[model samples]
Target: EDGSAAWLRYAPLPHDSSHSSLPSSIITLNSTRGSPVYTAQQELRRGIQGIFGKTLNNGTSSNQHGAIIVGTAQAYQKSYGEFDDAKELEEDGYFLSSESNQVLIIGQNERGALYGSFDYLSRLAQGKLGAVSYVSNPHASIRWTNEWDNMDGSIERGYAGPSIFFENGFVTDNVTRVAEYARLLASIRINGMIVNNVNANATLLSPRNINGLGRLADAMRPYGVQLGISLNFASPQTFGGLSTFDPLDPAVDAWWANITNQIYARVPDMAGYLVKANSEGQPGPLTYNRTLAEGANMFARAAKPHGGIVMFRAFVYDNHINESNWKADRANAAVEFFQDLDGKFDDNVVVQIKYGPIDFQVREPVSPLFSTLRNTSTAIELQVTQEYLGQQTHLVYLAPLWKEILEFDMKADNRSSKVKDIISGERFRRPLGGSAGVVNVGTNTTWLGSHLSMSNLYAYGLLAWDPALGAEELLQDWIRLTFGHDKKVIETVTEMSMKSWPAYENYTGNLGIQTLTDILYTHFGPNPATMDNNGWGQWTRADKFSIGMDRTVKNGTGNAGQYPSEVAKVYESIETTPDNLLLWFHHVNYTHRLKSGKTVIQHFYDSHYEGAATAQDLVEQWNSLEGRIDVERFEHVLFRQKYQAGHALVWRDSINQFYYNLSEIKDEAGRVGNHPYRIEAEKMTLDGYRSYSVNPFHTASGAKAIV
Candidate 1:
């Protein structure tokens, strides 16, 4: 279990008995036989034993000294006459405070009590329990993580080890890990989780798999985490032996209803279904020429009877757009597909849209669909996996990227509307708005592939619970809890994490251009030449004279026109656009001057050099903390940092050389265009290069097969 505990390591306090102030006795007020409240009590005992090396008594008297009390508002009111102010909280909200001789943890309901227990334990773990007093409520109704895990035990974009939910071709027999996974999620107040990939397999609907899901739900029930599933859109036809999957077809509706009934009969508290349809060869309503809403409503109607909901992904876009059509932009597809269907979906259906219009690039404009669907509920989809950010090799803190998206002013409703407000249902006054993170945790002891990368997972849940939390402050708490309270360890980890994303963005892509990585293979490393003439709609369109897609409204793909008028106008004109997004909105010559007064090519050269140097510095800083943390984690992190430092040079050189050769532009510093990088300077593609040379871990044979 060297890396298994993650942030819940619960190491003993560093100071003497003076700093050890946590109570030794505990009393849970709830009398529910075997509910989530009982789970909370169990967690408190485990955390207490790990932290203080003491057993907590369950039936401590109220007059006893140094005892902790936990219960629902009604339970507390009936016992203590409502003096603790628990009744003022929302359903999942909790109140925590330390009184004279007793600590109080009260909640509005059972789930709330579970959250409060975790919060109290976290405070103790961080040594912040002395004067704790707060009423905490999540910003969204449902904070969920989609696993993208398959029944065969392989995760699609997973950098971690194999799946804990499955092995071979079905759910694992001994599901001890399932309960442990639920504990981690519950501690972060993440209410819901989908256990399968959105591109689901039809075989999961078999009676054997149905029973598998029931067992999975049972494992998660005690932790207060609701289990959901990702549905194969063509299941009616593929799994049910139906003739057609047409949404309006009576046979399809009956098939889905019957399946839903069977599932609920097994797992009574099943959450719902998540579907990715008509995108990337996934079967959807478009096959039958029906609207997306019609397809989503079909599933929603079936789940409504069981008090469930459906999360229909808005990630639909044709991957096979002809390369000849310059106006065919993937960034424009989501809004076009979903905008007309606003207010058309059933009340139980939520349109889940990705954070950006395009796939989860390092930087892109927020999806216009957030503002377009005024009458419908929308969830912002974020990628917690490091698919586009070095795949857990580099330490990239995603809170910075997520914060930019959450704080963006979309100008929705012609007013001050931020993405967070829109997704929280404040801007649209609709229910069912929240967030979903594409979580990539597997059976790896570190949870995520790298130990440092766990910060992204922690931040996703913390921010989804409350977007107002400071990214740096949260990182500090995580550092204290996970790595212990050594001052040097805290400072070193904080500095490394805070600067990670900017450094990554600097080396990979610049000026609002997406990460120039290989999309066809692993979605990893710098492959600038791979962008041109691709049918994936992820084109850079770099040629002899200019670079970037012309997405302007006047003479381009008109993707800028999808935004609100205020945002659209800014991106429509090069003179008014920000330097960061200059390329994203307009095609620019290599010499085009940015707001920073540097030519586009020069800025690219400087940023790449700067970023590469910063990556090396990160390795040095982490090396300085050699004896400060656990030796096992220290050595593992050092290996990753060393790998990142060396690989960053590959990214910097490959990208700089690709552009320099194309534009025939010399680097002002004269460092680029000097190295011979095994490239056919004429072809610009690395077709002859081996994958082992590109990334140390991959083989040429394996990479080509995927591509």
Candidate 2:
């Protein structure tokens, strides 16, 4: 009820549902204690017992009627004689079948078998117990999550609580929560996890910590989750007492090789290293004037010997950007840095690119780097942590946003090059590619801070496995498993989740304006002034006459030119650009008419009020399910919805006020600057208080308030 179990709750079905058709017992071909097949057997037992309130006997042979046989295809063939369908399974692919009194779950590999078990349990938990059979294969080979957890028990952008993996600059001794986390990840088919923060501490490479990492890996290994770590690029000089940490330097390369060897000795199945270099002040090969590929391939060479693949982040950008320069765009940095280095990287190195050109904003065009780096491997990096999207205090399901990016047609060579196919290693024929989600789960029992937020995590896994799954369908599956099979709960949650991202984008930053958050410090609330007139390139550039970043190639930053020619043409021309992303690519006057037949300023005003009104409606919808849902989760979600409703109004008023003050335009509806129901603080009676002028007047109505 507290949501600690997440979607794996396995709550019993209605009493009227028949259990006779379900398998009566379980059997595993390979029962090695720590193996993935063994884990699948355990999960089957747990799920069956929880769902049916029945403890089926464990059988040794497939001859037993109503037996569920689970194991790798090799094991299945050894016991029951032949599984021709095994050839059809890719790495981590599973074939599941249930007919008559027998059910069989077979995998291409042991990990695949484990995935098959979870798939079966998902269907059973969703109350689909009739006859079902299917083959499920992941879209790509590398499905991982990057946790921004630091050594001091603090996650960089973490909202939930303290770190579960580390504390006081070392891995935690009690890894019970780590095991539980691996279980949740296993259910979602996430095979790897980078445990430390990308802004890493080199102390994790110490001998003692290496053993600690082994312990963490051991905890996750049974569930088939491999542990990876982020590396501080300067570890050789900073931590190992070397003369230089340059990638090409023989001593530095040897140091890294030794360290990688030590780590693999402890954790033979270590996933690999994640490096953020030469960007945001992180030290990299650029310090020694070496290429980013030289920096990445150094780690790839080290890890490649141990069957590991490096995930080098493509988020490199100059933090100190001069906003006055019309053509200096941060969005162009990724392609500028990596595009020319294509095919120079080692085979095991995968360039991890964010879904957008900029950071995880409310809306952005897909990163042009994906199409630019044709000869190199790639993976789309997504944020499940909701850094700029209300930080979990507001409801925002991001599956739709992710789907838009994944299914986007990059038109590489004017062909059907969807982002999904490109990352799956099928479009360009790369050996290693997939997706990485920045999922910073802390100590909160809900995994994420909020109960509803887990849906994003669930959907991330589903989409990584199969990008073609519909967002609403995935939401329904998660709802059924997490909340229940209640029709009203499913419908209401789907509506709320589907409406959430658009509603958020509308109130915060419509028409491709970035999330209008306080960018300098806390990335929360409205602070339009802080966005511009700063070193950070996240700018809106709203002045007295016009708004938006002009990223067109003709007159502004040539960011549009970074994309392939076909895709570039659409973004380059103002007439062809979609209204949703008009401001992102063009600088326009306040009175510029949109394709929607409204002036830019009017659209902003209307969208804010309408979006806020929609937020208020969300609270009403949740209230309708008060008695139907458990009081604990109901009140928890209600608290957030209520806060979101109030915050949406603040967002509306502040943004509208900022633009209205800047543009000096009257609202056609006369809603701006006219609070008819408002009572000034100076007009109200005060006790032990004095009137004070508000600083940054857009934060509130321009008035002297009683303090």
Candidate 3:
């Protein structure tokens, strides 16, 4: 499959399949003209054709066998009687059931039907559709993605080459790639997308570009996807040709109203605006000494007229005061900024909170902002791009990390207070209009840039839809859909992906010092030496005998107080906290003993040596499947795996050598710092990104540079 189709890859099932016992009758309750409900009708027909080699009907039929009935809950209430009502469904949710004879998928709205459609296909594809006998209401209402691609075709933090929606300096006229991307998102029940980078350029909202966006909106319409765009905070002056861009200014409000009108004129159901304000030199209401709410509320006012919402990012920080302490905690900024202004937001504005306090690190505690934003709606942001997780080269499925963040209980004011329930509006019972916005950018034909990596994207969607789903279950489902029905392929790739996070953890940062790498602009490759120097909090605090940042309240950065009483009490003490996150919130010595009964330095030595060794095992494992998969895909992944294996050794050796030098501790195995061999200049083929100049689309050389 080569990962091109993502989870939507629907190969025709063999004739011997027994799902043929499904009923022949298909029916629709109440349908609309080309709405999301209509899209579900269309998709159901397409999926049935691929799966059973039979066409499904849109109108009612006497034969209830294999019949699929879909409608809004209201329509079903009027006709078939909703087993659940609006109050019961909490405004928007879905109820679905299908068996040997009758099948019904009803949503509270058209979009929900579309979601139900994809959920049904996933079940069938995973061979679990026949087992479902329950109605499901989603916990989180906002499932979204942010495409950090500029109209000039450059994708920020994107390893997959340029923006698929952009070529040259303008939006692409060739939109085939854009439509396919929409299908991939819709299959995962992703309902919203911001079409540009957070470092938004004012030029994107110009008439010509909005026209291009209209075309994209139309293509994505059938797939039940809505297009949102990032708004430059100074758009009032820059985009509208105004004298000032102040949120309180009447002119600024009028300018935004005009812009929103112009956008909706072409694509009436445009999702909304995503604003990155007061961060990274971006303009914001803070320039006027107004709260962040003022900046978001201004756009929220404009969007309210059109039934849209404004997603204001909570990822704000300035390194201006960064020189003050040995540890400047960037991880505490979000809650510090937004917690006090919780109830100040307009109804149509959702505070887009990053999962962790710091940027998308390999491992971080859940951001306290999710609990702090009580009145304001919130959407959790995640990055599917493996910026720090070895770029796209290493196979890392991020659902495990995401699951931890989503399921983290903040115990806000109530006991069942988790970040997921908070953002979902379930725990706090507030209105949550925004969804999860993931950063997954790559230009490889597969979209995410790798065959195995598609599982992360797939799992992100499933978990966003239903946060309660097990990470391993989601991984297994993705393995089946993306790679097909091969047992060996399923088992090997699944085992590898599940173990990948821990493996990456072992070699990179034993106790959360973080994968020591340079983080000035791009976050990639091993340079644990540079981890402490960057403006980030990755400092090991290493000296003669000590290592790690001390984030405890009594003797350190006082960041532990950010958590609720429950988590804070546990994390504040070194003995009670998990060993995996030791260095993250605490600064200890090499002599410190972990709960596992191993010394801190020994854990580092063992994990790096073991992790690198496991990477070699990964290559051997994948090599065993040489003839079992598509040769092109198998060989491509094998090449990358082999490279990662070698690179893992580099990570192991570099980290081992760095720590051993610092701690002056020897490996328990007596060979922690041993080098397998150093290659001569002629023997080392690691041209790295220098060799990647092949794809002109990706190369420093330009778009004509494919090797």
Give me the candidate number with maximum lDDT.
2
Tell me the TM-score of model 3.
0.91
Q: Could you tell me how far off, in angstroms, the CA of residue 682 lies in candidate 3 after the best superposition?
A: 6.4
Which residues of candidate 3, in runs, are more than 4 Å off? 28-33, 57-66, 74-92, 129-132, 536-538, 676-707
Model 1: per-residue Cα lDDT at residue 438: 94
Candidate 2 C-alpha lDDT tens digits along 218-242: 9999999999999999999999999
Candidate 1, lDDT over the whole model = 0.86
Clashes of 2: 0
For model 1, what is the error of residue 350's alpha carbon versus the real structure, in angstroms, after optimal superposition?
Answer: 0.8
The model with the greater TM-score, 1 or 3, is 1
Clashing residue pairs in candidate 1 are none
Q: Is candidate 2 or candidate 3 better by TM-score?
A: 2
Query: By the lDDT metric, which is better: model 2 or model 3?
Result: 2
Kindly give the stretch of ten consecutive residues in candidate 3 with the minimal lDDT sum: 695-704
- Pairs that collide in candidate 2 are none
lDDT for each of the candidates?
0.86, 0.92, 0.77
Candidate 1 lDDT over residue span 1-707, tens digit each = 36788888778877763344567788888656557788888888888888777788765655547778887777877877757466569868988877555777788888888999999888888877577677988798879999989889999899988998887778777778888888889888998899998979877888988899889888998878888999998898887888899999999999999999999999888889999999998999999999999999999999999989899999999998876888889899998998889999999888999998889998888998998999899899999999989999988999989999999999965799999999998888988789999996888888888999988888999899998888998899889888999999999999999999989999999888899898776789888777767778888888878888889999999999998999999999999988888888889999998888899999999999898998999999998998887689999999999999988887887788777878889998888856454443334455664323234212121123122
Error of 3 at 502 (Å): 0.5
